[model samples]
Target: MKTLGVIAGREMRLALRNRSILITAAIFAIWFPVMSAFGVVAGAGGDAATIAGGIAAITIPVGIFMGYIFCADAFLREKRDGTIETLLCTPVSLRRLWEGKAIGVAVPAYVMTLISATVTIAAISTIAGITVVTEPLLLLHLATIVPVWIVASAGLIGAAQLALGMRENQILGFLLIFGFIFIIIGLQEVAPGGPGISPVTEGILAVAGIALVAFARFTAGRVTRERIVLTIP
Candidate 1:
């Protein structure tokens, strides 16, 4: 537990020190929600359900995107510069290291998600001249489901970055970003009513997020130092 904290703290410090990454992430985190809220307010007229649905739609993708950005620094950069090899020589298990890294990344990413949600609510309220309150299901999605998804996303991406060559990781990164965009577009097309933030949808997404986290853990466990070393370039 102490080792995990130490590792997590290290990653957090690294993330904080990287001003460029922090600035980029903050911009996206703030930009997407504010813009979405504007569109929703203009079209939907400050309907609470519509606001909640809009928040739900944007927050998850933004959270995952933040995780994706940090994964490059947390996992890929270490492997690229050979620092991961030194960490591999330590007493900590690879799984713990990966978990710590994921936690570190997820914490900030989730915070950014919260910021995005808040900005969305504020923007909607400001534009429509009404106070905004999130629905219970939407609250549940933000409090639990979104963070879990961030961790799962970071863990999965970190595992892949550690196990793959630089070229492959670059390709994976591109695909991940585009994949999320396509998913959002598909959901909009399939459910024109907006992101349906019902109990059933939240429940299914929660289960899927948990399953993805477990899968990421399994994949991280399978990563060996030799495999990472061989893949480094």
Candidate 2:
């Protein structure tokens, strides 16, 4: 447990050193809420649910992009730079390393997600002067979104790096992710609406996220450059 915490702490510090991560955090913490409020005001006449839905719509994409930034290199960078070998040679088991890294990536995303959600919700309440109830369902949705985003972001990013890093075709991986996001947006339009729907959607997100985590784990444990190239071709 101590070893895992140390690993997680190290990754967290490295993420802090990255300017892009800081910039993204600032955007989510401050800019996103202000922009969401403006968008809601500009769109006008919608009920709070509709406005909230709109906010979620915008948030989902930004969330995915943020996920990419936060997670796309959870393991690939280490392997690329030969740090993985050093870590693997340490006393830490693969499971601990994976768990530690997962926590390292997810923790920041969770914090930033909460910050962004709070900012957006507060801004919306202030501007619309709407008596917003932070009801159980609303709270549930907020709670679920953070973990969902973390898993989805970590899984997708980790999988992409493992799958595409060999070809040095990272742009293709990003494009594919955006394509998936567009599909998700389109699907949301077709789905039946309400708070009840959030749980179901989150369940689906969790499934995909777990798959990615599994893939990351498997890749880290077993896959090699030769295997990656063979699989890609």
Best by TM-score: 1
> What is the C-alpha local distance difference test score of candidate 2?
0.62
lDDT (CA) per prediction: 0.82, 0.62
**C-alpha displacement of 21 in model 2, angstroms?**
2.3
- Over 1-233, each residue of candidate 2 has an lDDT whose tens digit, in order, gives 99989988987788778787778677766787787687775674546655655555555555556556666456567756656666766788766776677677776666776677677778877888864345443555556654665655565455556445556646755775676577556556555563223545555545554665566566556645444443342
> Could you tell me which 10 consecutive residues in candidate 2 have the lowest summed lDDT?
224-233
Error of 1 at 124 (Å): 1.6
Considering only N, C-alpha and C atoms within 3 Å, which residue pairs clash in candidate 1? none
Name the Cα RMSD for model 2.
Answer: 4.2
Which parts of model 1 are misplaced by more than 4 Å? 180-194
Q: How many steric clashes between backbone atoms does each model show?
A: 0, 0
Estimated TM-score for each candidate: 0.91, 0.73
Instruction: Please state every model's RMSD to the true fold in angstroms.
Output: 2.3, 4.2
Worst 10 residues of 1 by lDDT: 185-194
Cα distance off (Å), candidate 1, residue 116: 1.7
Looking at model 1, residue 157 earns an lDDT score of 88
TM-score result, candidate 2 = 0.73
